[model samples]
Target: MAMAAEEIEALITGGIPDARVEITDLAGDGDHYAARVVAESFRGMPRIKQHQAVYAALGGRMGGVLHALQLTTAVPE
Candidate 1:
């Protein structure tokens, strides 16, 4: 099953309360997505850790129902 953009954003925001999340359907198939996430909590985190935080927010749905995601994360400046 493909995950919706709203679902993705909800999951991310649910975990990272102060996140500013923007989700895009890269392939228009609902399975592939691109996300840009900005949060104050990511300030001191490494890029890998930042990506991991977003992935963790999805609650283990990344490779299963969610499929592909090209994710970018940054701290609010």
Candidate 2:
């Protein structure tokens, strides 16, 4: 099943646990998604590391179930 916005938000929140997450469905198909995640957890990490953290949260579903995640990560102010 394609993931809903809330489901994606939940997964990101589950990973960072302290983030302010925003998920937008770029396509109505529920496959193209854009996410902006802000969290203290990302404070010192490099951009690649931050993205890696989020991807890890999806486990092995990166290609099978989830596709086209346009991710943006930020450190909380």
Assess candidate 1 and give its lDDT.
Answer: 0.95
The estimated TM-scores of all candidates read 0.97, 0.92
Task: Tell me the spans in candidate 2 whose CA falls farther than 4 Å from its real position.
Answer: none
* Per-model RMSD to reference: 0.6, 1.0
RMSD of 1: 0.6
Q: Tens-digit lDDT track for model 1 on 1-77? A: 89999999999999999999999999999999999999999998999999999989999999999999999999888
Model 2: weakest 10-residue lDDT segment is: 56-65
- Top candidate by lDDT: 1
lDDT of 2 at 51: 94
The pairs that clash in candidate 2 are: none
What is candidate 2's local distance difference test score?
Answer: 0.87
